[model samples]
Target: MLAWLLQRQRPVPIIQMLCGPSGEKILGQLRVNSHLREHLRTIYAAPCGVDVTWIQEYLDGLRIPLLTEAQSEELEGEVSLDDLMEALGRMVSRKAPGPDGLPVEFYRAYPTVILPQLVQCTERCNTVAKSICEEGQLTCHAAHGASAIYRHALRRLLHTRKRARLDPDGSADNVLNLK
Candidate 1:
């Protein structure tokens, strides 16, 4: 089966790919970088005419409470190896690989080897994040911004007693019940 799978195949002619005029035009356009840049800019640019005052206000409110000395210290606390391991265990093995082409399975399969390095990396990231927060430089309000900014430092310390399967009330208690 492996031998059959590894068998080499004949390459298709380039002329076949550019058989049509539209295909030729597309091939020509692919050589230019402007289209790629324009596409990315269009996709990533902030929405025009939208009032971002509310977002700024919300962030400002969050910063005032979090910037307290005690809170900042808590945020800068050492990462727990147990919690990191638990989170790693929860990761789905079949999930997509990151940019380095390493899937969650790679870490899960060799926790002893990878966990230490990962813990160090996560600690460094936390330190940088804390510094950024302290410097008041975390200003991005993109739709898919960093999760560190969204998760409150206080909330991390709270231990969820039970994982409630369902809650109809949608109260603060119910929200806190979530993992």
Candidate 2:
């Protein structure tokens, strides 16, 4: 398989893919990178994992140390300027750039300039998230109220129609009398 893959016509740079899906020993270079990545992800990705309901009792019995109220508050508190600066200082220099392709050195060079921007961006993101959550909750409440109102209305309508049907005259007068 290795020989066949290596011996194949040169297209892209020589990437020796020794291990692959069971069906295809060697994937063709003609296959797009995205497709190849998807296949690889499917083959290698960790599963969602097994259901742990059976071990719920055991899990519940396990004694876990509880954080103090103060400790919990501190942990959940908004990231401070000091915290951001400390984190920036702790970042290792000259390491591989992140997804943005910006090296740590760039931030280190102009800490003041970047720090404020980063903090502002984070704050804005937090605000937007909070607003979205509140809006979602309000929408959910409104929907529930509307659903209840509709159900009540429908039930009343049905009940009125039923009463009219049972009337001695067998007329829809009771239903028509409803405001």
Candidate 3:
């Protein structure tokens, strides 16, 4: 995975251009290689609705630009980044920050809310792993992985937020303070 990460990072942007226009029929979704396109398509193939659109916007946040709308569509069959940006732009107009200055997406995807939920799910899986082992499993793995997942999710959302990045609700050490 480490080697793959280094080699395959560039294709992320390529996939975006492919998906926006076509919705789900994007071809060559990954630029460096198409090996992971199927897996990505599977992950994004969930029921089409608000949550899916939200994730598409978040993933769109990760795109790196390249201009080939027609050529790309000819090669692939869609405009991914365009659709994602459209969805995100729609969300922008809908947001009216409440008294707390938080958009509705905050309540839907808050770090505080998301982290505890992740921890609870991770803890259960770790407990099962511990029981299956002669020696107990380490809780730290689940803790660390959950924190990383939340951090990555937050970064994606924050990336989409642009200038209006989510504010830290606590101290500088709040990154790990999922509670």
Candidate 4:
């Protein structure tokens, strides 16, 4: 009850997904990044993900510290940013909205190329596709295109890069330079 009350004071920051019951409203507010927003909206329209109730039930037996440790182990090694970009590219393209703001059937239309890309990091959807390619692992384009997952990944990457003093010009060896 205390947790619930605390949560009530600050709602979960929901990503405005496409294709749920509130799709129209979500779409309408997505004008700044129209193309990207449309795609996200459609992702929700498709029925996906595991059941929340079942997931919570499973969590009951797990201890919080153990879960955190397991998560830490899971991300033991670092994968390339390009891989992440590729994954997101395919995800957004297939799951993203079309010009009409409707969901584009990524799997059905472009199955061969998109499947492998889904598991890798993606960077094709946003303004950073070309740069991510040229900059090798780090690029402003990649940073800009990074989805929520990438943001989390970038945070860690930036912290580590800072500690290493990788870039003298504050560009982190040109890995994350917008200018």
The alpha-carbon lDDT assigned to residue 94 of candidate 2 equals 84
Candidate 2 Cα lDDT to native:
0.54
Tens digits of per-residue lDDT for model 1, 34-137: 44556569878957887999999898778331233443344434556665576666666777434567888887888888768756765666666656666777
Model 3 clash tally? Answer: 8
* Model 2, span 11-72: residue lDDT tens: 65465443454655555555545557787798789786888887997889987656445533
Compared with the true structure, all predictions reach lDDT values of 0.51, 0.54, 0.44, 0.46
lDDT of 3 by residue, 1-179 (tens): 99988897654453343443346554543542454655578779876555577778888898454524442232222223333333334455347433447665664455455435544654454445545453535465554454445333333333232212223333212332322
- Best-first order by TM-score: 2, 1, 4, 3
Q: After superposition, how far is residue 27 of candidate 1 from its true place, in Å?
A: 13
As for candidate 2, its clashing pairs are none
Identify the runs in model 2 with alpha carbons over 4 angstroms from their true place.
1-52, 96-98, 136-179
Task: Show the colliding residue pairs in model 3.
Answer: 19-79, 19-80, 20-79, 20-80, 21-79, 21-80, 22-78, 22-79
RMSD in angstroms between candidate 3 and the native structure over all alpha carbons: 23.5
Worst 10 contiguous positions by lDDT, candidate 2:
152-161
For every model in order, what is the number of clashing pairs?
0, 0, 8, 21
Off by over 4 Å in 3: 1-91, 95-139, 160-179
lDDT tens digits, residue span 40-122, model 4: 79887988776789787888977542223433333323444553444444444435432445344644466467534643543
Highest lDDT, which number?
2
